[model samples]
Target chain A: MSTSTSTSLTAPTASRVAGTAVLLGLTLAPFLLGPYAVATLSRILVFALLALSVNLLTGLTGLPTLGQSAYFGVGAYTAAVVAKNLTDIGPLQLLIAAGVSALVAVPTGWLAVRARGVVFLMLTLAIGEIVYSAAVNWKPVTGGTDGISGVPPVVPLPGTPALELDGLVYFYVLAVFLLLLGAVTRLGSTPFVLALRGIRDNEPRMKAIGYPTRRYALTVYCGAAALAGAAGSLWVSVQRFVSPGDAGFEIAALALLAVVIGGTGSMWGACAAAALIWLTRDYLGNLEAVAGRGPLLLGLLFVIAVYTLPRGLAGVRLPHQPSRKRTA
Target chain B: MAGWLDGNLVSVVDGIAFGLLLFTIAVGLSLVFGMMDVLNLAHGTLYLAGAYTAYALSDGTVPGLLLALAAGALVGALGGAALTLLTQPLARRGHLDQAVLTLGITFIVADLLAAAFGGEVLPTDPPASLRGTVDLLGHTYPVYRLVFIAVAAALALLVHLVFERSSLGALVRATVADRDMVRAQGVDIRKVLYGVFAFGAALAAVGGVLGAPILGPGPGVDESVLVLSLVVVVVGGLGSVRGALAGALLIGQVQTLGVALLPQYAPFLLFGTMLLVLVVRPHGLVPSAVRT
Candidate 1:
C-alpha cells in the first residue's frame, strides 16, 4: 500500500541506473571474489529467493506466514531424492521441486487463506511444525534427522558436465536466480499483482469490486510456495546435502524476518536483507570473536532492527520513492 | 476389555494432567490476545523462565516448590509488565508488528535463558513428599502427576470463577468491551491493562513451575510449549477460559492417547484434530460472545 504511493507511474531514471550498477556488480562478483565468498554469495542468493517468496505473501498479499519452510523443505527433499535415484539435471530437478511444492501448497494454502490476520498466522505455524515433524518422522523418505546425503552434482543441461566446482555451482545458482528475479519483476506489473495488492489493502472492498479475493490469495500463496521450493532445490544443489534442519522453524522465521527487515513489498529490499541476515548468522557467527554467540547477536539484531528500521532497509532512500509516512 | 481400559487409564490421566497444564498457560494467552488485541508471541518465554526458576530454586521440599511458584509468578509479572511497555507503543501499528516485536523478545529471552541454563534438557523432580506412586485403576501412577492434576483443576476452577463470576472480572470484561467508556467512568484503564497482562503472565509462569517436572527445561521447549498453547487458545475460542479448558483437554487427550495408540502418526494426529476443529468452527469451538 505504501509502495503504491511512492512508486508512481513514471519510471525513476536514477533508480534504474542504480539498479543496473548493482546488477553489474553482482554479475562480476564471482570472478573477483574467492571460491568461499562465491559460495556464500550463491547461498545468499538462494535465501534471497526464499525471502522473496515470503514477500509475495507477506508484503504483496498481506499474509504473514511462517510456513514457507515447509515448501522449501519439500523442494529440497524432492531434489535430493531425484538426485539420488534419477538424473541430476538442474532444471528438471527445479521443475519437479516447484511443481510438487505448488501441488502441496494447494490444500494447505486453501486452509490457510480461509483465515485472516493472527488466525492465519497460527494456521501457517501449525502447518510448518507439522511438516517439520513429518520430515523428522518420515525416516525412510527423508532419512529422518540425518537427511538425504551424497547428492550428485547438478548438471545445468542434460548433455553438460556436472557442476562440481563451487564457482560453477555459483554460476548455475546465479543464472536461475536472475531468471526467477526477472520473472517476479515482470509479474509485479501484472493485473494479478494489482488484485493482490487490492486484497491486501481491503479484502471486503476488493470482494465488493467483483474480485475473487480468496482465489487470488490462494494463487499467490501457491506461487510463493513454488518459488520457495525452487530455492530449496537450488539449496540442495549448492550444499549437496539435505537435512530436516533445512526445513525447520528457524529457516521460516529468518525468511520472514528478512522480508520485514528488507521492507515489505520491495523485492530487491527483501533480497538484500536476506543476504545481510544470512551473513549475520553464517559469516559473523563463524568469526572467532563471536563464535557460539550467533543467536545472541542475531536476537540483538532483530530487536534493534525492529526498533530502528521500522520501514526496513528498502525504506532508507532511493531517489524514486520517498520515506514512509510515520502514522504514530 | 478390562485390560484395554487398564492400559488406557494411565494415558487418560496423563492427558488430564497435560490438559490442565495447557489450560493454565493458554488461558493467559487467550485472555491477553482477546482483551488487548496484542499477540504476545513471548508468552511461552514466561513459561520457560518459570521452569528455569523451578530448576534453580527447587530444593526437593514443599517450601521450595512454593518458593518457586512465587518466584515464577513474580518473574512472569515483571516480564508481563515489561512486555506491556514494549507493546503499548506499537498498539496502533497492528497485530503483525506486535507479533514481530514479541517474537524478537522471545528470541532474546530464549537465548539468554539458554546461555544461563545451558542447552540440555534439565529434568526436575517434584517435592520429596509428593515423589511416591499411588495405585489407580489397578495400576500405579506417579503421586506428583495426580497432585498436579488436582492442583491444576483447582486453579482452572478458580480462574473460571474469578473471570466469570467476580466483580473484578466484570470490570476487566467491561474494559475489554469499552475501554474509552470505562475510562470515562474514572476507571484507571491502564491499571486494568497492566493487571490483566501481569496476572495472565503470572498464571503462565505458575504453570511452568508446576509443569517443569512433566515437560522439563530445554532449549526448544519454549517453542513447543508456545505452539501447544497457541493451538489450545485457537481451538478453545480466543478469549474464553472455558474454551481454553476444553481445547487444552481435547488436545491433551489427542497428544497422550494418540501417541500411545498410534506412535508413528502422532504428529499428523495433532494437526489433523486441529484441521478438523477449524473446519467445523472457524471462530473456534466456543467463541466469546463479545467479539473483539
Candidate 2:
C-alpha cells in the first residue's frame, strides 16, 4: 500500500506533466484532423481495449490465451443483436455485452484453468475456434459468413441524440475508451492484479502459501473476457455490423501479439501497442508502395521485438528522458 | 445394404488414410516437445519448406517425387539445425523463451515462403503411378492414398523400432529422463538435442512431401499444420509416440468423417473433441513417462 502511494507520487513527479500533455494532444487530434483520420483513431482505440484485456491475462496472470476473440465475438454479436432487437443505447449495450461475455467465460475459464502452460493456450484456442465455427455455421441465428449488418447507431450518454455520423461517433467512442482505460488501469493496480502477477511468476509458491490459484486465475480470466466483450461492443457500434470473422484466429492472435509488443503487465503499454498495430494494418499495410506486405512487416516486427525490445514498447527508452531506476 | 455399406465404409477408409497422414506429421511434434521440453512453433515451417521443395524440384515423375522427398528431408534437417543454433542462446531460459523464439521463426519463415512462392495455394499432383484408383469395398479409392499410408506406416514402424528397441533409443530415453545424468555419463546432451530436433524436423517434412498432394501447399498451411500438430501433441501427451499416434488417428477420423457426415459442424467438431480430451485427461491420453 505504501509502495503504491510512493509509486503514484513518483509517476506524477516524473512523467505526469508529459502524460497529461499527450492525453490532451490525443483528445484534440480529431478536431485538427480529417474525418478519415478520426475514424481510424476510433478503430485504434477499440483495438487498444482488446489488447489491454489480453495483457491482463497473458502479462499479469501468465495465461497466454490465444482465444480472446471468443469473448470479443460474443460481445459484438450480443451488441448487434441488442441493437437490432432491444435497444440502441450504447452504454446499456456495452454493459450487456460485457455481462454476457463474462458469464460465458465462467465455464470456459473453469475448463481452461485446469491446465497451465501451453495446454491452457491450446484449449483456449480450441474453444475460440469452436465459437468461430459456430458463428459461421449457425446461419439461422448468425447469418453465416454474410454477417449481421445495419446495426442501429448507439445513443450517446444521458439519452442524447444518436451518433449517426462517423465524426459524431468518434466522440462517443473516445468517451467510452477513456472510461474503460481508467477502469483497466485501476484494475491493474489492485491487490487482485498483484496476486495475479505473483501467480504468473511463482504459482506453486503462491499456492503453498494457501492462495486459491485456480480461483484467482478464473477471476482474472473473467475480468479480461469482460473487457474484451466491451471492446467487441464498441466494435459492433462503430462498424454497424457483426460477423463470425470477428471471432477468427487473427483477432485473438493479434490481441496477444499486441500485448507482447506493448510489454506484458502494462495496461497503457498494451493500449499504445494496439494502436500502433492497427495503424500498421489499416494505414501502413494499405499503402500502395507496401501493398500485400502487411503480414511480412508484422512478421519482421515480431522477430525484431523478440530479439531487441524483449520488454516491448513500454520499456523502450525515450530519446531525451532519463532511464528509470531498476526495482529489486 | 451394399449401397449403404459402400457409402459409409468409403468415408471410414478415407478417415483412416487421413488419420495416418496426420499421425506422421504429429508424432514428431509430440516427440520433440516431450523429450526436449521445447515447443517449436516453427515445426509447420519445416513442413511448408518440404512442400515448397517438392514444388520446386519434382518433374511430376515417381523418381522426381522420391528425389523431392529426400531433398525435403534434407532441408528440414538444415532448418532444424538452424533452429537449434538460433534457440541455443535461450536454451537455459526454458520453454517460454523457446516458444517466443520459435513463434518468431514461424512468422519469419512463413513470410519468407510467401514471398518466395506467391501467396497462392500451389497444388501438387501425385506421381503418374498414383494417378489412378482401385476398387475397395465397392468404392474406388486413390492408389496414391494407399501408397502414402503404407509408406507412412513403414516409416512409423522404423521409428518405433529405433526408439523402442535400439540402444540409441535407450540412450535417448535416458537423456529424456535426466539430462544431467546423461551428460555426466559422457553423453553429449547438445548432440542429443541436435539429433532429435533434426529427426523431428525431417519427419514433419516427410509428412509435408507425402501430404502435399492432399493438403496442398498454401500460405496459411504452415499455421494450420502447426495447430493440428499442437492438438495431436496435447491429445497424445507431449513426447509420447504412442499418444501421438492415438491422438492423430482419432483427430484424423474426426476431421475426414466429420467433413463427410456433417460438413457444417466439421471445424467445430475438431476443436470440440480437443476440448473434451483436455477436460477428461489434462495430461493427454498417454502422458510421457519422463514428464518435463
Candidate 2, position A74, lDDT = 92
Best by DockQ: 2
Give the C-alpha lDDT of model 2.
0.83
- Candidate 1 lDDT over residue span A1-328, tens digit each: 4575544534466678888998898889888999888999999999999999999999888888889999999999999999889879999999999999999999999999998776677788778878999999999899999899999999999899999889999989999999999999999878999998888777889999999998999999999999999999999999999998999888998998888888888999999889988998888988999887777778777778777876778877635444332110
* Predictions in order: lDDT: 0.88, 0.83
Give the range where candidate 1 chain A is weakest over 10 consecutive residues by summed lDDT: A319-328
Evaluate residue A121 in candidate 1 and report its C-alpha lDDT on the 0 to 100 scale: 73
Q: Which ranges in model 1 have alpha carbons more than 4 Å from their true place?
A: A1-11, A318-328, B1-3, B288-292
Question: Candidate 1 — which pairs collide?
Answer: none
Q: Show model 2 residue runs off by greater than 4 Å.
A: A1-12, A317-328, B1-7, B92-100, B288-292
Give interface RMSD, per candidate. Answer: 3.9, 5.0
